[model samples]
Target: MSTWMIYGANGYTGELIARQAVRDGMAPVLAGRNEEAISKLAGELGLESSVFSLDDPATVAEKLQGMELVLHCAGPFSKTSRQMVEGCLTAGAHYLDITGEIGVFEMIHAPETSKRAADKGVVLCPGVGFDVIPTDCTAHKLKELMPNAVSLSLGFSFLAGMSPGTTKTMIEGLSGGSAERKDGKIVPFPMGSKKRTLDFGKGQQPVTAIPWGDVSTAYYTTKIPNITTWIPLSERQIRGARVMSLFAPVLGTKPVQNQLLKWVDRSVKGPDERARENALSYIVGEAKAEDGRTVTVRIKTTNAYTLTALGSLEVVRRMLGRDLPSGSFTPAGLFGSGLVESLEGSGKFEVVE
Candidate 1:
């Protein structure tokens, strides 16, 4: 019996991770609620699998028994992570998930959650994927360069399509607007409220503030009091986001979400193989001290989904192959900023002071 499992193995991102894990000579148990999809993937990869839903805590815990680690890849994590996290606590299994949701990061990094993970002798690390790994690492690097920094800004430029799960997650949070960290507290703001022009390895482009997970995780990692995240966007897209902000509550309704998700399910197929092969993402981060000193770093990395697969599996391998401490962590908190450059397609950060 394998000690590790990949929940939501049938999901687009989950399947990518599972396949890559197999290619790297690891045999992780594939588990998900979709019996046929899970079974099919398991058979194709020649690995064990379990089928279960997260609706029942007892059932989830029972299924998680004997698992030392579980890579949760299902979403929207707002609805799925709680059950999995609780089950991992009960089963004494270390938990890792590829979540970039600000709320999910805050939930997992809360003091109570950290205490429970410590008591159970398990590590809980979310956002091990594309969501925050690069940005978090870059932020950590900037902190090292400017130890007295009081604020940090992170941004990325990745022109990739979203998976159905990702789309659904966005739909669920449409009403929440965007978020940023101020004085070490997470605060919500209107969508597209802030914008910046940064050179993400490419030319200068306008990036709009987004409710990226770094708004929460970066605070935990760097203790930076103020943090804002951004993504490249066109003027039209910025306007669209502002207009959408007005209807966030309505768009977040159950009926509206259901209808929108139906369209996502029908149309969203994520990036195809060719796109994944050619995908490149650029990340930029700047840390500014109150005394007017600043440090900025930029990174060029692989595709978001590909990087997610690589980052998650790399974390799993290191955790299983060594004696890392048991506690909650941001990806860079446990692994260090070097983790970003250790990946296959990651380039060393170009620092500018």
Candidate 2:
């Protein structure tokens, strides 16, 4: 049997992945920097556990020795991904992470790392979450329908819930202004002001250009000349995000970001029972062909984090099962349209043309 590792297995999302892995009969090795937490969760789930801190390179490489793949759940990935990815590559293990950080995603696409992973014949898939999967898959689906699409407009309609860690990560990213490729070059954009309303059958809500994983993943997948991703926000949250955006340069300071993260951690719930019951994410994309023809694709799902775990697990299963091409790639290039179909078959989502 091939061994799999679930790093950060004690986190809310991490634990969820661990549970799903066990259910799939994979019996992953639950691992993290915190021994007690990992051990407790592993014991409860009837799985093995290990301790490996990303801060210690040798330890990480050692712990990953026998694993064929790893599902990294801990974030903010901006801080931890490099080391984790390096360790995985050093151990000759396939890697997957649910990272929405544009910086981290871009880093993985860097020439050196990309060449290294390719040369080693290992797979490196990032953004296996609501961020990239739904958007990238939607882009792929649209291209299938329109074949000649040159640009895309994507929006997410989500009313469900957010984990404390996710909230903190967003806050941190917002405090630092986000940049997107515009006219083929990266440009800074205010986190809020670019609002557009999206119809999700129920009603239309104003969405803002919050930096999302789709910005990077879509470029890699569809080769579209332009792509924009938006997320629906309540009026109040929009106001807060706008205000924060105004003072982003200052708020992005280390002390301020740390304070904001601490506050969010205390106020937001990571993943309570309520969140599991109420979570939802709807992604819609519009693709425009050169001749001005258009095609639209939409995907809706519940339990966003659960689906993220499921997506990552499915990717790992495919890699281990010899169903994926051996190369460092994003989800789109690795699984393509088949990924979207698999998620739909999971009975957790619906797709509409």
Candidate 3:
């Protein structure tokens, strides 16, 4: 039996991952800083629980011992990834995280940490969420269809609701402003910067180039000269997001952010029959080859969080099942275009070109 550990197992996303793990017939060790929450989740899931805090590296390393893999669901990963990565490396365990924060991605990709993980032969896969997976996987597929692709544009449309963590991450990004690659270098784009329209087959909707996890993932994975990722929203929602962007600096403060997060937590709803039935993500991509030819690919899925867990789970299964080279790697490099087919088995996605 493969022993997996789910850090932050009490979080909204963490619980979902745990539920899926049980459904897949894998016994996962639920762990987090909150002992009560972890115990509750473990009891509910009929799994074992452990206590580990990101603030305490020794405890984190101890908790990670003997685990084949760790599914990290806690975020904002900007605050937690370093310690988690260190602990995973120390324990000789594979590390995966559902982080969409570009700053965190850059931090993990730093020379020192990347080299260390590679040297230790541990896998450090990030952006395991809706942020970059759909886009990154789509980019990989597009590149296969057009190997010389020099630029890529990814757009997403979802009628589904967002998780509290997802909402808070957006608010934080809005408050801090967004950045994107332009002219071969990363440049700051104002919150909600660069607007474009997406034709989702159902209809056309406007999207803005907000700072998202994919900005860095695509760059690291594809080495494409340019990449852009966007999520579509209603005009009213876009306006509201823009307004929130104006206030982000003030609300982004620790106290204000905590207050806002509390409100979000209180109001947010977790996945249920109705919510899962209504959730869906439509991702479309346009890749421009160096020869100036453009190719397009489209992928659609339901229940973003479940699909995310499925994607990460599939990666884990593959890593364990195969004789993969040991090293820190990005999703695109590790799975390449095959991620589409891999995810298809999860019964969550469809691809149309």
Candidate 2 clashing pairs, residues 3+ apart or interchain: none
TM-score of candidate 2 relative to the true fold: 0.92
Best by lDDT: 1
Give one digit per residue, the lDDT tens place, for model 1 in 1-353: 34899999999999999999999999899999999999999998899999999999999999999998999999999889999999999999999999989889989999999999998999999999998899999989998898899999999988678888888888888989999999988889999777878888768898899999999999999999999999989988998899989988898888998899999989999999888878799999989999988888999999999999999999999888466788799999998999999999999999864
Sequence-dependent TM-score of model 1: 0.98
Error of 2 at 112 (Å): 2.5
Full candidate order by TM-score, most accurate first: 1, 2, 3
Task: Give the worst 10-residue stretch by lDDT in candidate 1.
Answer: 318-327
Worst 10 residues of 2 by lDDT: 344-353
lDDT (C-alpha, whole model) for all candidates: 0.92, 0.77, 0.77
* Residue range 1-353, candidate 2, lDDT tens digits: 88888888887788877887888788888988898998899899998888878988888888889788888888889888889899888898888898888888878877688889888777888888665777778777777777777777888776557777688788777666655656544466777667777765567777777677777777777777677777778777877777877887787788988888888867886766676667666777788877887776666766677678778787777788474555557786778766855763233223444
Q: For model 3, where is the 10-residue window of minimal lDDT?
A: 344-353
Please provide, for model 3 over 15-116, each residue's C-alpha lDDT reduced to its tens digit, 9 standing for 90 to 100: 887888789987888998899999988998899999868988888888888888888888878778888988999998888898888888887777777888
Residue 174, candidate 1: Cα error in Å is 0.8
Q: C-alpha displacement of 328 in model 3, angstroms?
A: 2.6
